[model samples]
Target: MDLEVGDKVSLIIGTETHLGFTVLIDESFEGLLYRNEIFEELKENQRIAGYVKNIREDGKIDVSLQPQGFRNAIELDTEKVIEAIYDHDGFLALTDKSDPEDIKKELRMSKKAFKRAIGSLYKQKQIVIGEEGLTLVKE
Candidate 1:
């Protein structure tokens, strides 16, 4: 395989299993995208971009919908949260305490990602974490 960890590739969504969705990578290699790593809806045969997460010694490959690495993934998730806040009129009814599924439905990101983004925003003074939710801090 000509792929390395973090390498971007084209993916065709395949069968869903108890573990996750199987994917055809770069139209040649077979890989698995874990269910727990997925946040958005995916259909069979759907085409999407993916990143190589790992390659087992046995030749099995692992893939991800988002770019690998903390910096790449966090930036994207953070932007999503910010956009959600704006879409909800400067207030997002999701806090660090929000359910994982709710955060996934609202931001299409995992709870860990949401918390990291929110924390980043808070440190930057870009948003306020309130009992009700997150409020955008006006400039």
Candidate 2:
């Protein structure tokens, strides 16, 4: 079967293998959703909306549940976005590069969302982005 890129499809999580896990794209081909693409918490028999990531030379096709236009689990904990911004001392400074991405991962927010939150803090004078990581200006 031929699979085109950017094709929106829903898949059911199938067997988890050492090399990669399988997704039942349909009755015919079982796509491989590698560990890299499976960033968030995923369970066996979970259904997910995905895009046709690519087809490998080894005949293993891949799917990305993190495809564009997909809503993440972050919305479930919107308050964490607030906490990441506020707890990180308002400014996600240069030194905070690692934390920002990590926070986004744990918080399930995109880097853009993190930046926007910091921007809001900056405008409100709650914090400042400078040479160091976020500084608690409110103190």
Candidate that would win on lDDT: 1
Model 1 misplaced regions, further than 4 Å? none
How well does candidate 2 match the true structure in TM-score terms? 0.53
Write one digit per residue (lDDT tens) for candidate 2, span 80-139: 544665766564443336465575565555555556555665676766677665564666
lDDT score at residue 58, model 2, on the 0-100 scale: 81
TM-score each candidate: 0.96, 0.53
Separate clash counts for every candidate: 0, 0
Question: RMSD in Å for candidate 1, one decimal?
Answer: 0.9
lDDT of 2 at 41: 74
Candidate 1 clash total?
0
